[model samples]
Target: MQWITIFKKEILEDWRNYKWIWVPLVFIVICIMDPISTYYLPQILESVGGMPEGTVLEPPEVVPSQAIMMSLTELSMLGVLVIVAISMSVIAGERKSGVAELILVKPVSYFTYISAKWAEKLLLVFTSYLIGMLASWYYVDLLFGQITAGQFFSLFFFYLIWLIFVISLTIFYNTIVKVPGLVLTLTVVTIMAMSAINQIFSYRMPWFPNSISGHITKMLMENSVPNALWGAVSITIILSVGLLIASNFILKTKEMAD
Candidate 1:
């Protein structure tokens, strides 16, 4: 109940402070950009002498499921960037402004405060992904045809896993770095490192959340049930809990320099 109250307060604070604007804008842009690019790309290429003589450039045949997955991947990456930016500021901003001390003085424990913030951010990310998926559906329907519920849900679920992984990375960075800029830089570097490592070693490692999501998306698009779905789920669940535990531990031991 106390955590719920804290979570509610955090949501209200986000609304009041205009933190809700970025998610919608970022996701909407992703939704609109995907179909527009997929629809007019060949035409744009043709206009630019992209089709050479004797080389017929046929329009790329995009399956509805593939298009949805593609759009979801693009939007989800953007969501990762946005979430990292938001999470970088989550703790460091409060600490810089002396708000951390004020909040700590309240009845809230450090664990509650950290957990509430993460929960709020995760909810916001999920909402953003949902809006982006809906927008993609509308655009795809207008351009192509209606997609199946299975297709939509599968793609959405894949992206949701990606989002959770990104959020976990962000929270991990937030706990380690006290400056927003440093946290953001570290988060990006961490993401890149993970991607590189995953490329080098294509296993279902717990550290490679983004890659796991991509594999899941590929599985859905190819209409193949991933053999490692259970493994990925287990990784996600374990990593999420691990991140929450680490964040709480750091918050509990952190000293207020103010």
Candidate 2:
């Protein structure tokens, strides 16, 4: 009941702020743009700058899986930045407005307050992703070729798990930092830095959430998931729980308004 109450409040706030609408629209554009643009890339290149005479305008073949994967990569780089930028103020904004203090004065636990943020944002992230991805999948089939349902869903399912880690980590960072700009920078830097580190030692830490993007690409190109991928899922789950606890602790001790 407590979580439901907080979840409703979070949703209403997002609605009022237009996050519920614009965030999904951003993802949909990113997803659909990939296939549509790739399908017309040759035309686009030709129109922008004329190709040399006698040059064969043969574009490389676009595979359905690869097209979808590219759409997700857009999500990873630009999409993560957009989503984090929009949701960066979840905790930080509340604290600045003194809403956090007002809520804490009542019979609310920090765990519930924090979990509500985590859950609502997670829902926002995943729901937008799924819709965008499904649209991408359809257009990929239309523009390129069809991938087996098994292959497409496998790629999507695993990628979604990693996205959960992204949203959760951002929420966790927001709890610790009060400045939205600093929070945004730190969250992006930390996650991107971790991804870069994992890339350096990929063989040893294939299960890292950052690695999931590459793994999904791998799955698209190859039919099988690498054995180490499950480890990444397990690690992400454990890390998500740890982040929730850390955020809860911070909200209780240091989440005061300035």
Model 2 backbone overlap count: 1
Task: Give residue 52's error in model 1 in angstroms.
Answer: 7.5
lDDT of 1 by residue, 1-258 (tens): 878998898788778977787677778788668776887787778788856677766667876666666676676567577888877888777877788888777887777877888889889878877887788887787776667667677767755776776777777777776788988898888888877887777664644565666666667667765756556656776887788789889877778664
**lDDT, residue 34, model 2:** 72
By how many angstroms RMSD does model 1 differ from the true structure? 2.7
Count of residue pairs whose backbone atoms collide, per candidate: 0, 1
- After superposition, the stretches of candidate 2 with alpha carbons farther than 4 Å from their true spots are none
**Candidate 2 CA-lDDT value:** 0.83
Model 1 off-target regions past 4 Å? 45-57, 203-208, 222-224
The local lDDT score (0 to 100) that residue 5 gets in candidate 1 is: 90
The whole-model lDDT of each prediction reads 0.74, 0.83
